[model samples]
Target: MMETGQVRDFAVGIEDSAIEDLRRRLAHARLPEKETVEDWDQGIPLAYVEELTAYWRDEYDMRRVGTVLSQWPNHLIAIDGLDIHFLHIRSPEADATPLVMTHGWPGSVLEFADVIGPLTDPVAHGGKAEDAFHLVLPSLPGYGFSGKPEAPGWSVLKIAMAWRALMAALGYERFCAQGGDWGSAVTIAIGALAGENIDGDPCRGIHSNMVWVTPPDEVMANPTEEEQAGLDRIAWYRTKDHGYSTQQSTRPQTLGYALADSPVGQMAWIVEKFHGWSDCGGHPENVYSRDRLLDNVMLYWLTNSAASSARLYWESFNSGEMPQIHMPMGGSIFPKDILTPSRRWAEKTFRNIVYWNRLEQGGHFAAMERAELFVEELRAWQRAATG
Candidate 1:
């Protein structure tokens, strides 16, 4: 297994030909007509997509991004024959907690780049001294720089185990974990399996900022007049918001085929989520700079990972990974997300629920959309749970 520090470079780096290909694909994009949906219920608008494509083709600079990221200390390790990429930013402070943060689908370690400088070196960033950390942001297997797992069994649970090994390799005996979306699920698995009361246990505490808490059993079990009214609202949401999940889980490749082929197709798919999920309401450019948003798209574009990323959606469903979320946990539920699982319902899966946050804003891509808020939320939970 190669050490992360050795293979820290993007293994499948894009060549000039790839850029030409993307431009060609975008130029000849055979866009289909859509009824003006008014809201983002259907998908991204053609106008917005064309603008994003223009920026991508004429302006986005992936090399500049790589150089900026090069300032950080990066590492990778061959885990079970797959090279797992990560950024291990060691705090200047000698006694910081080893905190491992994982990214979710359609996102990369790049998502946390903004907050890492502040989190690890807080005194320098106008934050308190107590905010120090040995941050370990890992690309989940089959995402971004992490090698794709050719085999099955590399589910969320397996990824958590890999992270435990990653922390151990870094010489951290005791550490904490944080995540959102798929990240939340992985961290939950780690916390639940921590200190198994048997030999060879490696996991520690977990803090997550993306839990879609459902309705309480009391309400779900026996609905009151108001609870029944609440159910009606949620039932309507399920009809509208659940389509993406259903498509992602059941037939990711069908969607991926379209996205993987065209840069414009991929941008629309990703940018639509950024728009709908972000606190910007429906305007993606409001929260993120065109450069920043395009950089994220550029990562996928450069690496050519749209299809592989979608396959994760298909695998999660095929492997029956959702029901395995039973674990000790803390969660931050955001109002902007598709569904909010009630604390009562969350406790069914997360038995040792210590901290539950019902945030006013943020959504599915919580870390990327509202990174500063996500960072603070994770830091708050990490302190509360550990101290």
Candidate 2:
């Protein structure tokens, strides 16, 4: 393990040979026969995969994605025996608050690329300087350029500790945390670990788009119509949409062999989620452009993170314990997201609910689907946290 305090500049520098190899793999991909069902009920349509893979091979620009990442200020620092990769962009304001935003599985720091400039330079984006934040975007361990954890135990709690160590290494003694998906769980854990229970609380507050609020049986014993609806969604997910989760949690390594070898297979695995999870009407292209979607896929493919990233589920999915968080909390409920717990349910776990919103649009990948709204949501949550 490298020294904890060491931070060095980093960049996305995939060589031309790697890019060529990706194209070659896409060109020679052996796909399955068309699904008998015409709709996505079975899975991603064969036609769509064929078209997407064709575009990826012939027209999509890999270099552009690299350029976008290169333009951002990035670094790598060791924490808990992993060389965690992150983007650290400072606000021009002398007293700007430091804010760390985490990304989840099937997502990357790319989700927040558009919000970085706006968050770090609020004035340029038509916000007050006081709203500025020195943004920190860390690629989760084993995802993107971050080194894979060599051993087990890099659960949400451990990642939260790593985030704190990261912030301290970067000279931030106090900061706020924001996230959605796995990022949300990590952010909540930070708040839970704060104060007298753990290390001194470096986290001032937390905001999440996908918060965990596992209400007790009594709360669910007589569910409201809305609560029942939320419960129904969860049930539906476990019944229909949870195959991937079950596989990832129990046998990620087995699935990884195929994902790591077949570019088309990897693309199909991830692209299906964006279609199912996003509010992209009927097609993923309704929200994400071809390049934008492919860029995220490239992060996972290039890093060969299929098994390592899925191992996160193996570590935490069945832990059956929710950390208690008493810090100021904010949540945005996107109607189309995979899970949107009722505020009543959320409040049971997030004790101090300072801000909550049921946004009219957006979905699971809200940052990418609704960048402007995501920014406003963060700013609103920040105000509630700071004030």
C-alpha RMSD for every candidate: 3.5, 1.9
- Superposing every Cα of model 2 onto the true structure, what RMSD results? 1.9
lDDT of each: 0.70, 0.87
Query: Would you estimate the TM-scores of all the predictions?
Result: 0.86, 0.96
Model 2: per-residue Cα lDDT over 46-84, one tens digit each = 999999999989998877667778878889998867899
> Which pairs, if any, clash in model 2?
none
Q: What would you estimate as the lDDT of candidate 2?
A: 0.87
Model 1, position 140, has a per-residue lDDT of 83
lDDT leader: 2
- Write model 1 residue lDDT over 346-379, tens digit each, in one string: 6656656667777777776677677777767766
Q: Number of backbone collisions per candidate, in order?
A: 8, 0
Q: Residue 21 CA error for candidate 2 (Å)?
A: 1.6
